[model samples]
Target: MSDSMVPRKPPSKGFAKKKKNIILLSMLAPGAIWLILLRYLPMFGIVIAFQKFTIYTKNPTLLNNIIHSDWVGFKNFGFLFTTSDSWKMIRNTVGYNALWIVLGTVIAVSFAIMLSLLTKKFVAKAYQTLMFFPYFLSWVVASYFLMAFLDPTYGLINHLQKQWGIEATQWYFVSKPWPILLTVAYLWKNIGYSTVLYLAAITGIDTSQYEAASIDGANKKQQIRYITIPHLKTMIIILFIMSVGRIVNSDFGLFYQVPQNNGPLFPATQVLDTYVYRAFMATNNPGMSTAASLLQNVVGFFCVITANSIVRRIDEESSLF
Candidate 1:
């Protein structure tokens, strides 16, 4: 046969697979574009962290500010460590985060396990809804709700205390009591969300494993200790790794709005986040804020890496990486 009359071979299996993968990948394009626009693009402003960023009086665009600003290098970073309140801020931030991470995990996991034990589907759903409701409420709105119960005079707690002939506490102004108050607020607002996540993971577990354990004369506690918990090990490790990554960050609204920003409460609630906000507001310095934010992100990034490495070293199968 002549070259012009040669027949072409059919598409190979790999070629068909590649075509199918391309179509599937196209489905992710929208999410990829959104991330690039909102997350990745803004990372270009990280340069402002090194600059003493000030708007040019003649041409004050953000780009112009970045170009005209003086390079202060590590000086902006030094501000975080050099301030008199630096130790206090760092302590509060790390301490609160540590407490939340440990307590939140224990409480969320325990609650999730309890919720999974609910035999009635309707009751389980109702409990989930109640737990999840606070996650939807904005911090601004939640602050008002907290104020209603904690108000010194007419607040529900104070009113009850008065009725019982107890002293009324000015909750917002008392720094000593805020540790407990903030802990409660943090858990109340956060635990439900975490519980719902673990509950979902628990729901995926094979019920037959539990049935088998039960037939072997294992009690409910024993079943949970072995079958239920072992199945949840991977999920728990992943969540812990994610939580570890954010160890340097705090919920700004919880520290600020929950106590209504009373000066007296600053001793207990002046975390890095709130401190940075206060510093930026006091000096109107973008460079300072940018440096603080960059520091947090870098620390968080390393934290995640370190946590994953530790988990991988112990149990390769459970590591997030």
Candidate 2:
């Protein structure tokens, strides 16, 4: 065939560029609007942190609040830094989040591996559906479920204890055992979602690798160690990096609700979020809440950056940024 007879047409570069821009804009508009409305707009309220904000003040105006309100430069932050509970809040937030990261990864990765091994399609689907059902339930609802099991006077544990002729323990008021309980609770409530993610990652992996490993005399555990773990490394690092950002942030609902906000457990369970809530309620101090929120955001931002840096040093390709 003659080259001229092929009738090749030149690509419309400008048209393609315009089409690409239009598609990009269309895809981004909704998220951009949502971020502006939900995330950025409320950031204006952060001024309340630097000001002595009194909700009951008669003059109901942002300008008045900014002007008349005393400018306590870094005083609120000072309180966060210097207060006795400050260290505790920091410790609890970081501690729990760190625990969550480790335990969550272990359970999720392990469960995903087991889930990947299941050959029965129907059973796998059913099991995954069952495991994922709890993710749909709100933390508030889950809190009630937790209370039913852990309630001091009349709870599932107490009832079971009675049946076994043993004394029921007051779990709510008990703080010493809370770290373990909270960790397990966090894992139980959250692992399914992570497991699903990891399972998806596992499924994305080529099966030929497993078959090849088997032919090479790699046992199940060895196959997993050599191929599966190596393949999942990227996903794990990505997840770990993402989790580090929230290291300074606690699950408000999980800590607040599951514990039923029992005062006695405050020492053990009082995270930055719950502490902020209490401070907000006691004095109705918007400043404290704002300060806490700002601190969390700042700390989270720094933590993510630091984590990404670490990840980059270890594996540049897997680093989020």
Candidate 3:
């Protein structure tokens, strides 16, 4: 047909809207599917926490198996609380995380501020690279690195002590110093990542704020107090809230591998995760293990909610929700 001989048709609004909706849905599909598969689907296993689950089930379906399993009300949870080590583990977990949150925030923010103050980009990059290197190392590898310095007989610290005519101390068997050692190790591994996060936030701050402060005759510390810190407040609060959520969780490797699972160090190093792992391994009790995990998750959920609520009351815009 010749041009203009045929009637021109307009685009349908309904089809256009449908096409746009399809594109939006397509963009959201992967994340939605991932959430369903990894998060929502696994939640079904929470029932196992309340059930006396067995491996010898004849049922082919998971739901059927759960239906057949004996339901024990809160016995599994009660078992965890009745143990002598329960309070100890809970104390260690919360204590270590509390210290970590405080120290990590301070150190990360300080390092980030230092990084922001650097005029030489290359020097700053080098320092940042060095700081971040330890974070990439696995806990197993980090443990060995620690052992090299801490091992009593032929370790570097012992060798140095020998040269200095001081007695070599057995580190792994000693519980007294482990709290400090573990805290240091945790800080060494985590500070880099935290610094990176804070640095990004700092970098996002308006340079004009600092310039204005400088024009007002503010010194470096004054500029930091008046301008930098106020800008970082939101990021700080968000990070703090997230950390609070994981108060019940601990670095299994840090508590386990780094200490080499030494019985003597259990007093200082045995956090909730490590305790649960050892208990589950020794007893082969899925119900107890699942119950422990469920408790941790529930506590963590409430912690996040509580932290967010507090922040919302103080500054609604800064709250995660």
Candidate 4:
């Protein structure tokens, strides 16, 4: 029997599947490497949260500085609670987050529904583009734009006030309106993103359900109540849980840059992130900043777990495990 007379066996399905899986894994390699390096590897430095974390020229290396730092137990954590501004910052952070969660969900869902109802596709796209542009603008740039509008002497707002026979108010110097301003700013920049999410979910729904409802004499509101809301209930719960997890993590740029770090606005605008930044800047302490960040993430993690557990109890299919 010559070799040429032997028949070649076909590749097995398991082998083909393994090859396909290898290709898919190869495609994911870059992102996996990036995640490991930038995210998980940094977890090793978390010990800095409990140390004095001093730097020196003896070794002049990151690992050396971390290894040489002295442990101070819970001293760094005390900085968050012992200050006079602690209560205020915590209150502002939680209050703004809670309010934004409510407003963001309501406004985003409403806007998404309205956009979905638009008969014209281009008009809906135009509106989405207009709303989404603000989300991309950095807080630094946003602050400059805000300054242009709120500057007492030359701002467009003051200019309009003069035209309307009203007193030109110095906006940054005032604290009373800051909570409202910050809320509006957050929604203006963020609502579009959430709206798009909900809109995508809405588009995935079967048009026949709506059509059937319409034929059954159900009105637009009734259809939304019966079909749409029930379909979106999962997404709403997921987003709500995610938002709750981030309740302790304030946006540093929004609190710090947007208000130009004004002194008077601290009463209304100060948050844990801004407080950590100020403390680190004043004391040049890495431990305090690291501790605060660690605390925020720990709290956020627990919040996510607790929310997911509650959801699992109510609806296992919709729960985010």
RMSD of each: 3.0, 4.0, 1.9, 1.4
Cα lDDT tens digits, model 3, 1-321, are 899899888889999999999999999999999999999999989999998876645755777777778999778887778889889989999999999999999999999999989999999999999999999999999999999998898699999999999988899998999999999999999899999999998988888988888998999999999888998999999999999999999999999999999999999999988888888899888888999999999999999999999999989999999
Q: CA lDDT, every prediction? A: 0.91, 0.86, 0.92, 0.93
Cα lDDT tens digits, model 4, 1-321, are 999999999999999999999999999999999999999999998899999998867977999998889999989899999999889989999999999999999999999999999999999999999988899999999888888989988899999999999999989999999998899889988999999999999999999999999999999999889998899999999999999999999999999999999998899999999989989999999999999999999999999999999999999989977
lDDT of 3 at 193: 95
lDDT of 2 by residue, 120-152 (tens): 999889878888888888789988887788886
Model 1 CA lDDT for position 219: 98
- Please tell me which predicted candidate would have the highest TM-score against the true structure: 4
lDDT of 1 by residue, 160-220 (tens): 9999999998888889988888899889889999999899889899889888888999999
Worst 10 residues of 2 by lDDT: 54-63
Q: Which scores better on TM-score, 2 or 3? A: 3
What's the best-to-worst order under lDDT?
4, 3, 1, 2
Q: Which of candidates 3 and 4 reaches a greater lDDT? A: 4
TM-scores, each model vs. reference: 0.94, 0.90, 0.94, 0.96
lDDT of 1: 0.91
Q: lDDT, candidate 2, residue 236?
A: 93
- Pick the lDDT winner: 4
